[model samples]
Target chain A: MLVSYQTLRARPADAQRQAIRLGEYQSHTAGLGKGCLQANVVITPAAYALDFMRFCQRNPKPCPLIGVSDTGNPDMFTLGADIDIRTDIPAYNIYRYGELADTVPDIRAIWNDDLVAFALGCSFTFEHALLEAGIDVWHISNNSTVPMYRTSIFTVPAGPFRGGSVVSMRMIPSERVDEAVAISSRFPLAHGSPVHIGDPAAIDIADLSRPDWGDPVPMPVTHTPVFWACGVTPQAIIRNAKLPICITHKPGTMLLTEVPDDADVPLFQKS
Target chain B: MLVSYQTLRARPADAQRQAIRLGEYQSHTAGLGKGCLQANVVITPAAYALDFMRFCQRNPKPCPLIGVSDTGNPDMFTLGADIDIRTDIPAYNIYRYGELADTVPDIRAIWNDDLVAFALGCSFTFEHALLEAGIDVWHISNNSTVPMYRTSIFTVPAGPFRGGSVVSMRMIPSERVDEAVAISSRFPLAHGSPVHIGDPAAIDIADLSRPDWGDPVPMPVTHTPVFWACGVTPQAIIRNAKLPICITHKPGTMLLTEVPDDADVPLFQKS
Candidate 1:
């Protein structure tokens, strides 16, 4: 059941999702379904779902919610007519009492009636726009996970959710930083514009060589470091909440949705 | 304590809110706080707050949530430094079992620890933009309420909230419709872009002259009817849900926030 990258790239978003569901593709979903919107997934018990949703609503830059499933429903009809939350994502991170206990391909074994699934927009969508705009996305070009750092910029809290923002870094040529902002700002659901542009120290990042998450890519002298609010923010905040049990898509292996990456629909209207 | 329009317009947002709170002002909020953001208010008991939040999240066009009070805590600190939900809005429409039970200047008597306040973006923000762009908003020019209609467009429902979208009509010069869209699209927190353009019949509006709500203004031959999702939608759907009790700002009277109408922050980021 091995699918070639070329063949997978040629298929539609639903087909790519089907391949992931059937265990045929289980790696990062970077280049697959290029024009499709990919989502960061979070599943929580219905009891805490409201607070978690409020957190996302309060801090949209870090957590732009694209869809929320009906309580206890495994299907995310709003995201896609046929998305199965329990299996479509290539991987799932299971957290027990605010700590990562396991990483699994699927969560069907533990699916329950009290769970709610939330889909959040990912940076990949804007990264695609950046590439199309002729801006160099260093991480994608170098075949590495984008470097992520937890910043001193605290997210506005809601209920049990409280934490600093986690941001992804890209070294953009100083001249193109404005262009990058204009392009990325168009995709608010995808983390929007860079939260910080020049100095990492100002946002409390001690080192560019080492990222709190993902791989660090090289920075050039002519380039300026740009930081965007990362999708991993919700996961970090959820962990801080120390919920009894929570589930999220493994970082970088997101749920590929049918929505086009460039769709101009307002963030709230997307649902 | 009749405050003159000129005097109120010269004061800051907090001062104006204080005036409203003290029963010195009890009229529509248009033209007041010209640069500040105004919001449609909806208050529900804690039991229905989650479902109502989900409804707003699902139907963001009609309910772009700008600020959500922490459960039962009515000082909407995020929206304004001293906004007391019970008294800040000039008027309150109390709905009991889906019926309009009373129109009061304040709801302090019925306020309880179990109620949650939600502030949604109002169209006035964009109408301000429209006027700045030199596009004529007929109703504002005529000093009449914007016409509203219940269209065939069914909102994506959540929990007991199910209803067709309610839209506000603006007859724009056909040539300026695109300009209107571009200007308004920048404010997604406000309804953002028209849901329907041109023929009213296409969206199931039988006549532009007779609206479901608001006063209808005359449409010129050179103009085209454009409709944006109206904030009244949440009230309509909340009524349909027939919650034991609900409270909303009386039509056209909204809560003014300190955030500038033109603030480029993402909708979700505003909270």
Candidate 2:
């Protein structure tokens, strides 16, 4: 039984819905759990918690924190009432010494006592908002991963976490640029406003179609490629830091949180 | 010799002017370092450093961080070319276990190896911008310390630091309120825009006059009392945390830095 973006968004947080997702129901989470906030998951040892948190704090635009789990605790109650971190996600990406180790469905066996899970805000929330406002999310329109690029903008260094920003690309028609920015600004938890609206090379992305990660979906004829801070920043930082072991959800395989659609997530508020 | 705000603003290094301020020159900081950003100062021991930093990060509106001193170094070179934290401000407030102990010009002799100084953005920069844009700063017109109030807004708790938010008040005529917000929004490092406007009690502030601290300037008949997150929040948090020893500048006395008025602050950057 395959689910669609519209179906997932409409019935996000149906445990049966999510349980089915875990019961050999593997699929990308682009539109799952509609009205429910989906988060990008990153798990690392406690040794890097402080620095990683500082990194997120310093570079909020790219990595807005939604919930941080206590050390060794896999129950992310704050993000989702019944979230069992070990088996909630459909898939996980294991990285060892900055290299891809393996992709697994459930990380229950690998969960450690020193691991801290961070559920960061993802672009799906804002992309939903954009579409609701009649703006086109380039990747979604073409059924692909939003093109992501490494930018020249330097991020504030924190302990072992330091790297340039990673941005996701979206295309907005010229006339609706202001509306795109305005609507997105309301969802700061989701990448906030566009980081760059016009030029691709200006932010150091040499090629538009060639992205560092994720499938690149090109822009339409009448649309401008608008770049936004992406949730992939922490993954990049963790990779660059070369931690002994780190785990993340495969791109597009997000953790569906129980946070309601109209959840009060003010820019700095504890939502 | 006295330095005029206009003349001091034109000077290349504000730390030098601040060094002069330590030498018996007592004057308000407005206009003094026109392009240079000035900040509210709070100095404390390392025991409370992490909590305080967390407090600021959790409640950024009133506590936008500009620079922090290396324990007892007193040299905030990152903020200015030659900032001497120990004697940069014209005035200082010494608090002993949450009680006001003494007010002094400098703490060079009492400086210890465990002290950490924090420089937070003040509302002066944004207020200056508002005034320049033809928006009347009611408190400035009344020659007062922009009315501040202790609101019911609870700051996200961090260790021993927890307290209600303190907001500085300004009365913006309804017509120019949007423009005032726009001008102030650009200076997030300097408290950003108003946290609340129109009513005082809505945020738990009981009285217009008789502020917990600072002067209480009255609002105009047709103007809305716009409130901004204030720098004094950290001071209040430190006081409640009840650290054995803490030091901060007097309400109006601040540490002037060389950061240009337009220098980009890292916290607000999208990428």
Candidate 3:
């Protein structure tokens, strides 16, 4: 049986993590816990961990690192209590040698002491902020995934991680563009503001109808396309790197955490 | 021959660089080229470059990375158009096996193809901001160095870089503490905002007269102590790492760049 959004939506992150840990919920986490942050998970072996960390540091816009689990430890105490890297996420997409090898609910069978997990800030927080500010999100209203495109902007590379940037697009009414920029700029952890605005050719997005990933939404005559740095760029780069073992959230199956969605600060620290 | 502050102050960045590059100006860069951002320079061999980069990323409050040179390149084009990292700075402190080997006018003789320079934002930019905001700087008024202390706060470690955070203190009138924070918070590149305010013991400072580095200015009776993350923390860690060779700007001497003293953004992009 399914539960109401009120029942499952605003639960404290701990209870939500408990549900996910117990396998009670295994689905996209878009509306699971309103106002709470949902993180994109990436777990890789120790040998490639530093390189991955560098890649995130070099290209912060696409890969905003919020929390990193200590090497060989499945727990991220800094992010949440009782949060297990191997099982807390709703679903895992295991990539082997750059190919999707298996889709699993949990990874206890393959869990090892050599794995390190990274919790990256997701775009959901900013999307939530935009909606709060009364800006229309075209894809969400139309019941579709935000359109993503591979752009000409080259991400600063580190080691074997090298790729062009990827951005998710939403059409906002021309008058609401400033509000979109101001609201979105407050969430650097959520990829901050748009990487480009107004022109599709500026970042090499030639065709709006045909996106490289996600659903193509209609651009209303009054709206303009706004693009944000997408977290999916790292996944594509890792796949291109042909790492021996790489795991990520299955698109929208994010990990919920107790940390509040701190705006503009990608790496929020308690002072 | 020594030049007057009036001769060099407010000169365009190119003229200042030319003066330094010609071996004419070799002293503390405190008053040189006002309104420009001064950087704490760190050049190291390529072997330890990635680890150092990670260290800066992990400890950004103290080591705000304004610019990073391409590997083996003497040019820091991202920071300035005509920058020659090997010669532009007024002075360089060379470290061999983690020991201070010598302080030189320039590093042209030791410059190698394997060196990488990291230009870190310095607090001088924020002090300029404070002055413009009508806040009197204690050290500048007294003609003394700001007191710095090693705090109990542990910086996030990356690889071999590990150390307690270092902070520099300024005494603000009790009524102006909030204003102090509000103004300083604008310069994230320049150690934005107070890491600790009011009490000295809160961050483990036992006495105002003593500092781990820099000369001390007397604390005023009506003023409360305010501290900001010092860039020296990274230098301390890098020194502790025992790398075969490292080079940095001598304590008070710094590298001046063309970037403006942006209040919130210390990492001012563009030439």
Candidate 4:
């Protein structure tokens, strides 16, 4: 299942996206399709789009922009052909005044000409790389959600957006730390490498047992917690700003894109 | 000097910049200060800065932005401390209406509050990486400039910026092609790996002998021409746009910065 350059022509992205559009698929997009990227979605008014784009540019780790829609245009042709932003994802979280108003299956009813959609690189792209390299993801193996925590590191502010970073942690044996770094760093769009390794308190995280989001997995005494800048950081920023309206894809569910996982080629062939 | 993390604090960048600023050294910056990143400078009006930044973002392979200054600011603190964008570089090329106006030792006289500066990742950064990995750059060995050609590859346009990409070619022994690709691919900011390898016709580059810029190097019979996206790409775009005014570093006489050669770090060094 190695997504090599020669094999990228296959169009699983179209079929998978169709399934999502029809509301046939509504769970986590963890292993939905191979050879293509899955993106975190954000929709906001045109007025806030430019500032939000600048925010993603300044803090690339938290929000690596895969594609930005033209004003009032719902089609993100850069990410794929015939893709409609409003109905392409399995679920959408509509926020009003920065608070969650309702969770909907489709944003088509609420989509407006003044709204702009942004597709962000998600960790699922790099997680595929890790699995291919024989690195067992702890939470995935334990059948639980990946643990995420709020860190003391503040994001670079953009317009009204400002907040501390939220990071996702994976506990691994000390020896496999290098493998984790090697596999993950290749996908800079997918948050890149570990921001803090071993010491949770370095980022002001007091406990690994109490994650701010998702289920916590048990770690062996020999394992060390490695943190990566999470896509959730932007959500935190959006929440803090309390803008007029912001719509996003619910966690786990995502907007799949046509881009290959090896957007930037990784080091070494998996021979 | 490997420019390792431990040796980065010595601050040789300041001394090298001072020598350039004093007019003490004016030669091509092939291997000036070790461990620091060298940048291709572009200064334009604040009116065009946003579009130009978007242009760089759209065409990252050709114009990889290392640091973009705050609008109307003459300093680029991201690349270095105490960086005066107008006069720090050894030389500047003033362009008016897409034509060369004057080549000056410093641009302080023309510097204005409406000007914005951009420091782009140069091939010099990756050339250092190649040499460290035992890859011989033909032009450097022959004491000539690397051959550059205007390619048929169209860059993604932003606003008024639009042009074909300009690529620089390096002749390498055919056997070392894999090694060259492996090593250079680590520096995405430095144009990453070869855009076209072996066949120039593939990229619509007709002749390698007669380059549009720089001295042409003799190619060994066993060598292949490997082309990487050149930083001159933005210059071509600027020329095409024919803006009111624009300024850039004279080719080969780049602005050196405190950032590392491997500004985009490789994987697996963490413990």
Which has the greatest TM-score? 1
Q: Candidate 2 clashing pairs?
A: A8-A33, A8-A34, A9-A34, A12-A33, B5-B32, B9-B34
Off by over 4 Å in 1: A1-7, A266-271, B1-12, B266-271
Instruction: Let me know the TM-score candidate 3 reaches against the reference structure.
Output: 0.84
Per-model chain A TM: 0.93, 0.90, 0.88, 0.89
Q: Rate the local accuracy (lDDT) of all candidates.
A: 0.84, 0.74, 0.76, 0.76
Q: Per-prediction TM-score of chain B?
A: 0.92, 0.89, 0.91, 0.90
Tens digits of lDDT, candidate 4, B1-271 = 1232223223466666776776655556656656777788888887776667667766778887776666667867556667788777777888898888888888888998878788777888778778888888876665566778899887867668898999988888899988888887878878888888888888887887889878888888899888899988877778888888999988777888876676453111212
TM-score of chain B of 1: 0.92
Tens-digit per-residue lDDT, A117-161, candidate 4: 888888878888888888778765654567888998767665677
What overall lDDT, based on C-alpha atoms, would model 1 receive against the true structure?
Answer: 0.84
Whole-structure CA lDDT of model 4: 0.76
Instruction: Please identify which of the two predictions, 1 or 2, would achieve the higher lDDT against the true structure.
Output: 1
CAPRI tier for the interface of model 4:
incorrect
Pull out the clashing pairs in model 3: A186-A264, B186-B263, B186-B264, B187-B263, B189-B266
Displacement of residue B10 (Cα, Å) in model 1 is 5.8
Displacement of residue B126 (Cα, Å) in model 3 is 2.2
Better of 2 and 3 by lDDT: 3
True C-alpha contacts between chains kept, each model in order: 0.29, 0.04, 0.00, 0.00
Total colliding residue pairs, candidate 1 = 0
